[model samples]
Target: MAFLESVFAVIGDLTWGWALIPILVVLGIFITALTGFAQFRFFRRMFRVLWPGNQSGDPNAISAREALLVSVGGRVGGGNIAGVAVAITLGGPGAVFWMWAIALVGMATSLVECSLAQLFKRREPDGMFRGGPARSIIHGLGADYMWLAMLYAVCLIAAFAIGFNAFQGNTVAGAAQDSLGIDRIWTGAVLTVVAGFIVFGGIHRIAKAADIVVPVMAVAYLAMTVVVILLNITAVPEVLSSIVLNAFGLEEAVGGGMGAALAQGLRRGLFSNEAGLGSAPNVAATADVRHPISQGITQSLSVFIDTILICSCTAFVILLGGVYVPGAEAIDGVVLTQQSLAWHLGDWTQYFLTFILLLFAFSSIIYNYYLGENALSVLTESSVARNALRVIVMGIVFLGAVAPDATSVFFFSDPLMGVLALVNLIAIMMLLPTCLRILRDFRQQLAAGVARPVLNPEDFPDFDLDRTAWTGIDPDRR
Candidate 1:
């Protein structure tokens, strides 16, 4: 076990430290330039597309709102709460500034990858949409690179389906045990049942469930943060200033200096919002929209919500209450957040936090399952195979909740996701011309007085596209 841990630790350090971080930053910047900073230019259009009642009218295709919720469920999770707290503990308040910086550039990366997903998405026999890095690489790049697509699929299954799901379940159970005096076994049993029922119903059920939960939990959590900020209003300016100062090595309280702040902030930000990781694109492909860029624009909003809004809320809660002790080894993760909240809102806040954590973690589990299912679809077409995989996913959920060793799970999952991100970034880079063209086409339509931009495959005959998928565009209008 020790040997395995050492091996994984080394791989994780090399994968994330030397490779993924630098590449992610460069690619994000490159894409941001390529798109004319679409994330900023189309910022208002993002919310306009997200307006309620924006439906594609395809029964099998999920509504734009449902798609947004699914992506939000996947993006906004334990990372927003526990992950943010860990960043502030290790990187000081300055870490929050780095987090914001990543999200700002990452919005562009998210737009490109998600737009590609929507373009290459295939309709399943059940009428549901299925696409991600695998489909995009295969359909967009060509069948010759199917091997790379398959490799991505396998890595996604290992990282999100089996490894990350276990990690999330462990987090939920640990919080319950700490706050409610519940046994791990009981927590595991309950989670297994609840997660099993929802996951087995497949993507539609998952989307429906996420639609209801993501909004309520996010709004409620944000409202709580507002209350805390109001109660500690005077500290707000000081807290904001410290974050900026610490990010640049100007603050002595930040241990390990600016390097640590940048590393932790970027790492946790990527983990929380998953901008360039290629994870969110899997779910983003499931949305029904007039233009692929519409979903892309909508998904950019998710990155903002995850890091800028949700993660910022966690940071303020910890910093405002004065519970975060810089250079202290004892406080971190959800515990740090919970303790800080207790300091401000009283001891009863701990129980409230535990409940919120459960919702956050459980919603993540559902989203993770869909990612694994998408990967499984690439490898096999059998319903039986998919169902069997679902059962195993549930078993992992139970095991994760009851298991004592979660370090191994994190160690294993981190490298796999790193590899997944590497492959996805490369593919997206290769497809940059296509993504840029799509954006240009969308902008032209908008300028020409089109209310909602619609994609026409004939616009780019040089590239391979699934024409049937874009047939929803009115022929007469064209």
Candidate 2:
């Protein structure tokens, strides 16, 4: 086990520290500049597109709003809570600043990939849509790029479905045991059963579940954090100062200095918000909007909700409650979050946090399953294979829950995800032309006084497209 950890750590460091970290940062800035920073420029329009004036009569159709919720559900998972705690534990308060920087850049990266996904989406047999980097790479980049698309789908399945889901299960199980004295096996069992119900149910069901759960959990958690902040309102300045000063190594503290902070922040922040990682594009592609860019805008807002809001809330709670010991051994996870919340509110709040983490974990699990399913749909539309994947997911969930500790789970997930995201980043770079064209088209429509921009297949005559999916989309209808 020790040797295995060492191996994964090596792989993780290479994929993230040396390669992906620089590529993601530089590409994010370049994409942001190329798109005229659509993420920030269209910031106001993001909210307008979030809640439709009215819902479409077809309940099964995935709306832009539902897609946004599903993306948010996936984004605001264990990564926001336990992952943030781990970041601070290993990278120190300085890590929080880097998290913010990554997120800011990530918002723009997300806008482009998700928009391309929407433009290149295909229709499912059930009349739903499915797309991501894989489909976009195949269709938008020409059939010659199909190999890259398939490779991406495979990596996405490994990272989101197995690697990351296992991490979520491990975090929840650990939290439950530490706070509520529940056994890991029991937590795994409960999670597996609840998750299976939604996983087997299909995409609309998952979206519905996300619609109900993500908003409530996010609001409740934020309100609680607000209370914690007010309680320690006087210390807020100090916490802020530490986040900035420690970020640059201006103050003497742990986190090993700025390099550790940047690596941890970039890697973990990518995990939490998933801006450039290409995961959210799967759900974004499913959105039933006339224009692809609407989904892009909606998804960018989710990055904000995940890192800027939810992840920040957790960091503030830990920093304010004074439970985090800077420059420690770097070995805490969700339990640290629970302890800090309990310190802020009371012992009972630990129970409350456990409950919240369950919501976070399950919603994310379902989201991860959908990504796997979407990726598999690209390889084979076999119901048999998908069902087999479901069983595999459940088994991995149980195994991760029963694992000795979070460190082992992190070893597998962190680096595996880095490799997975690297594939998508390459695809995003390849599809840059299509992405910029889609963005320019959307901006032109808005400038022409079109309140709701819709993509017409006729407009994109130069490119191959899935017409059935966009042929009859109403421009004025929600």
Candidate 3:
């Protein structure tokens, strides 16, 4: 086990430390340039796509808003709170600037990837639409590369489905123990039972749960941060200035350097938003929308919400509360966040944070299950196999909650997610032209005064598409 952990750590260092991060930034920039900065150009349209009563009316399909909520549930996790605290602890205030920088480009990367997922999505026998890097690679890249698709599926299953759940469960257990005086064992047990009830119901249940929980949690968290910021309003300008300066190596505090700031920011930002990591595309494909770009744009907004809005809220709470000690070994992770909030809001806020952590971590676990289920669907069609996987996942969640150490779980999962991102980025790059074409078609229709853009696979006859899925013009319109 030690040897395996060492191997995974090394692989993770190389994949995330050296390769994937740079590639992700570059790809985000490339896509942003290619789409004429569509993330900004169509910024309003992104929200327009989320207008209420925008359902596709397809029983097997979720509304674009529900898909956004589901993706948001996955994106906004423990990372938003604990992860941001860790970054600021290790990378200083400047890290927040880089987090915003990555999200700016990541918005475009998400748009392209999610759009491609929609283009190549397959309608399952159960009537759900399913697609991701796996389906896109096989359908867009052809059968000759089916092995690559399978590889992506395996990696996603291991990373998101199993490994990530354990990590989240561990975080939740720690928060509960620290704040609520709860036992890890009990926390794990409750989490396992609650998660099983939802996961067993599959994607629709997950989506419905996310739609209700995500918005409320996000709003409440932001509201608390706003109060904290208002309390420290006088320091807001100084904090803002420090972030920008430190990002460029102007600050000389603990963990203050451009390199440290950039690394921590990008890493945590990517983990939070998951824009170019290809994880969101799995859920993005499940949305039923008239134009693939509509879902893509909707998912793009998720990145902004996750990192730019929610993560920033966490950053301000810590910075404004003034609990962060420069160069202190004691400050990191959930504890740092808890300490900051308690210092600002008093002792009772710890319990409040504990409850919030449960909501954030639990929602992430549900979202993670859906991603794993999508991957499992690629490898098998058997209901028994799927159910068995769910059981195994719940067991791991329990173990994660009770386990003393999470180092190995994170080491194992990080490299796998890095690999997943690498495969997805390569596949999406190959299929960029197709995504661009679809975007152009969608934009043209919108420009022609169509209230909602519609897609017709016949327009792109040369592309390899699941025609049956795109056979109808607009189910909502009809």
Candidate 4:
């Protein structure tokens, strides 16, 4: 395991460079600048459109709320908690600042990706909307990029479905075991069963489950964090100072140099929100939205919630609790957060994190499974093949539960994620002009009193938007 982990680590290092960060950062800056920081202007309207009871109707598409729920289901998971904890422990409290910065940029990255996915989304034979990298690659870059896009999807299934799923299973089982003395094997077995139930139900099931759980779990976890922060309000100033001081290479105040802080913040933020990773667009593509930009804005909101709200809240809990001592003993992700929580809330704190992790981990397994399904669907439409893949996913969930090595999981997953980012970012960069064009069109229609901004597929030059009888014409089908 260690040997394999080392090899994977080397691969990850080779694929992911410090240079890519600035490239993505610049891409994000460019998009926001070009769009006039649309995220800010659309945020309020986004909430109104995405919130429950306001979802527009479509023949074969999910409600806007359901789309947001599916997107959030994928975004808000164990990474928001444990991933943030790991960042603060290794990167210093100041890493939180960088994480926030990434999410702000990540929102733009997400909008671009989802916009492209929407622009190129396809209606599956099953009458469901299906689109993502595969559709986008074929539509924007042609069949030439098909192989590369499929290659990316395959890598993503392994990295997210197999590798990251293992980490989540282990985290949930381990936390439960440590907190309640439940046997890890039993925990794994139970989780495997629960995941199987959700997987067999497909995307709608997964979205519904996430809709019910994501908001509830997120609120519960945030409330706990709020309590912790308020109780330790006095330490808030020092923690914020530590974060700012560390962000700019101030080693004297932060204790560690800027590199550790920057890397920690960047890596954790990347893992948490998965901005450039190209995972959430799969979910975004599944939604039934009138305009791709509508879902894109909705998804952009999700990125903010994942990294900025949930992940950032976890960081504040740890840093404000004052449990993080830079360069201290070796501590695992959730364990460090657990210890920090316990410092403020006593024994009850452990249970709180344990429950949160279990919910988060379970949600992650479903999400990873959905991404795998979309990737497979992109290649073939075999039901048998789909079921077989589910079996494999379940097997991986069980295996990951029993695994003990952390580095291996991360190492194996990291390179694939970098590859995914490269492919999707390239696609997004290539499609930027179209994405901006769509945003402008949507904004114009809104200004013209088009209360519901549905566009005609025949009118759009890029791709079809209708999920049923698409025929590349809008009013003909509707």
**TM-score between model 2 and native:** 0.93
lDDT of 4 by residue, 1-478 (tens): 7888777777677667654676677788888899889888888877776455556455445666776776776777777777787777677776888899888888888888887887788776676777887678887788777897888788878778777787778878888888999887888899999999999998878877887888888889989988888887888887788789888777533456677788778777876777767888888887776777888888888888888778877888777765677778758877778888888889788987788888888887898888888888877889998999888888777876766564254566877777778878888887788788888878887897676576556666554344352343244223
The lDDT of each candidate is 0.88, 0.85, 0.88, 0.78
Model 1 per-residue lDDT tens digits across residues 158-258: 89999989988898899999889999999989888998899999989999999888988899899988899999999899999989889999985666889
Model 1 misplaced regions, further than 4 Å: 1-7, 406-410, 475-478
Candidate 2 stretches greater than 4 Å from native: 1-11, 52-57, 328-331, 403-413, 472-478
Residue 399 lDDT (model 4) = 78
Where's the lowest-lDDT run of ten residues in candidate 2? 49-58
Question: Which prediction has more favorable lDDT, 1 or 2?
Answer: 1
> Could you estimate the TM-score for every candidate?
0.96, 0.93, 0.96, 0.92
Q: How well is each residue in 1-478 modelled by candidate 3, as lDDT tens digits?
A: 7899889889898888789989999889989999999999989878875667667776557889999999998899899998899889888888999999999999999999999999899987777799988999988999999888888899898998889999889988988987778899999999999999999998888888898999888898999888999999999999999899888998855554888889899988988899888899999998878888989999999999999899999999988886897667756588888888888999888888888888898899999998999998889888998999899889989999998695365567888888888999999899998899899998888787777788888788888887777875654653
| Model 4: ten consecutive residues of lowest lDDT | 469-478
